[model samples]
Target: MPELPEVETIARGLAPVLRGRRVEAVWGSGLPLHLNRPVDLRALRAVAVGRTIRRVHRRGKYLLIEVEEAGAGIVVHLGMTGRLRVQPAEAPRAPHTHVVFTLDGGGELRFADARRFGWVAAGTPLAALAVLAALGPDPLSDLDAPRLRDLLAASRAPVKAFLLDQRRVAGLGNIYVAEALFRARIHPATPARRAASRAPALLDAIRAVLEGGIARRGTTLRDYVDADGNSGDNARALLVYGRQGGPCRRCGALIRRRVDGGRATFFCPKCQRR
Candidate 1:
């Protein structure tokens, strides 16, 4: 799944190309694509065609393209193997191309998902979009030590699981959470409240890793790319997420991996003692 940084990268890359550009047409594959609800081609054309794209931005892991009229917009979630890119209107569609938004001049913004897990939703009063409305505060913008402390203190789940809960702190996924915990020296299995005393450090670590990811564009182990079809550089800079059995950069302790809630978590046992 594309996390905050990846989603933000796509939004930033698309904003200039899409802003002020009118959607001239909307096309779908006719194959089943997750619509979030039952939004069909007619519904998409009604909200999108002829409306100028006001802006492109990200909320949690959702990408939003707001239109100029009635606070209406389109929302996209890149489930696992999804990609969004802009290319010449005449360019050949990629293998799984599911939705194409033809811009007024020459290009098209395309959404392709090999796995069909991603979704698209078009609606009015953007606030009425249930998925986006239910997301918690974006960690980069709204989270701080005190706020993180309160959230953690309320959960008995493992610290890793607590942070992974989108309803508690939006945009964190398994990859970033592992790196953040390693940086904060908090064990993934530590009870959330038990880790609350280190909330300041944990919050700083979370922000540091997330900011670093955005600065590097994002971590692309696979399938993730910015709107320009470029892979992220941050994967090479990862500290712990996929370095199982490798020596820890800080203490030379062997890096380790474990599965928590079916997600791979990497850490240094010596550094991240419970």
Candidate 2:
């Protein structure tokens, strides 16, 4: 799944191309792909067409394009194996391109999902969107140490799970959580309450990892690409997420792997202590 950084990358890349551009036409696959709770693709056509995109924004892992015409916005969630692209209107249409937004000029914004797990929907005012409304504070925003400290002090779940919770720290997923934990030298399995003392370092680590991921265009281990159809470079720069059994980049100790909250977690056992 595309986490905060990948989603942010797509939003940043799409903003200039989409802003002020009118949606000349709307296209759908005629099949549902879980848009806002398994809605039909036809449902999107009515709301998406005839709307002008004003801005692209990211909330948690969801992408929202403000529709200035109708005071509504479109929300996109790139589930596992999903990609979004902005291409010429006459570009060769690729298979699995489930949704296409023909812009007012000469290009189209496309949403492709090989695994059919991604979803899209229209939201009125965006703030009223249920999914976006439910998300907690964006980590890239005003999520500071004091606020994060309180959140950690109240949770008993494993630190990794707590970090993954959208209600706690929006935008963190398995990949960034593992990397952040490794950077903070906090074990993934440490109880959140017990991890409070490390909250400052953990918060800094989270910011560092996310900023690094965005700067590198995100980690493209699989179906992630920006609006320009470019793969991410952050994977090569990853310190821990997928380096199980490899030497830690920081300490030269053998990296370890475990499953936390049903997701693979990597760390240097010598560095990350419970």
Candidate 3:
């Protein structure tokens, strides 16, 4: 899944290109797309066609495009394998391109998902959407050590699982969580409450890794890419997410991988002792 940094990067790449551009037409593949509600092609056209895009921003992992009309907006969630790009109308459409919004100036904003797990929701009052309503505070803008401490202290689940819960702290996925835990020197299996006392360190690590990811354009181990169809360069800078059996940079111990809740977590046993 494209996490916070990936979504934010896409939003940044899209803002300049989309702002002030009117949506001249809207087209869909007729194939069903996962929607926050039962929004059909007509509803999408009602909200998007002819409206100028006023802003493009990200909340958690969702990209929000606010339009000129009051209370109207478009929200997109780029699920695993999903990609959003802007190209000339004459450009060849990538395989699986599901939604296309023709802009006034010969440009088109396209959403393509090979696995069909992504969603597109359009209408008024974007906050009313279930997906956006269900998200917690964005870690980058709203989280702090004390706030994270209180959140962690209330959970009995493993710290990794707790962090992965979008309701508790939005925009984190397996990769960043593992990297954050390793940076904080907290074992993946440690109970959330037991990790509370180290929240300051953990919070710092989280911010560091997230900022680093944004700086590098996000980690692209596979399908993730910015709006320009460029792969992120952060993969090689990862500390422990996918380096199983590799030597730990902090300690000479070999890195390890363990699966819990069907997600793989990487850590250094010596550096991340419970």
Error of 3 at 151 (Å): 0.8
- The segments of candidate 1 whose C-alpha lies over 4 angstroms from its true place after superposition are 34-39
RMSD (Å) of each candidate, 1 decimal: 1.5, 1.7, 1.6
Report the C-alpha displacement of residue 136, candidate 3, in angstroms.
Answer: 1.1
Model 1 residue 120 lDDT score: 81
Taking all chains together, the TM-score of candidate 2 against the true structure is: 0.95
Among residues 3 or more apart in sequence or in different chains, the pairs in candidate 2 whose N, CA or C atoms overlap within 3 Å are: none
Q: After the best TM-score superposition of candidate 2, give how far the Cα of residue 184 lies from its true spot, in angstroms.
A: 0.7
Worst 10-residue lDDT window, candidate 3: 32-41
Pitting candidate 2 against candidate 3, the one with the higher TM-score is 3
Residue-wise lDDT of candidate 1 within 1-274, one digit each (tens)? 4888899999999999999999999999877766444437787898999989998999988899999987899988898878999999889999989899999899999999998888787868677988777787888898888988998899999999998888889999888999999999999999999998999999899999999999999999988989999999899888899999999999999999989888898999999998
lDDT of each model, Cα atoms only?
0.89, 0.85, 0.90
lDDT of 3 by residue, 138-166 (tens): 88999988999999999999999999999
Which digits, one per residue and each the tens of the lDDT, describe model 2 over residues 1-274?
A: 5999999999999999899888877788766686435544454666667777888978889988888755677888888877888899888987888888888888988888887888878776668876677777888886888888898999989998999889888999888998899889999899999998877899999999999999999999977888888899999988988898889888889898877657788889999977
Residue 148 in model 3: lDDT = 94
Residue 70 lDDT, candidate 1, scale 0-100: 73
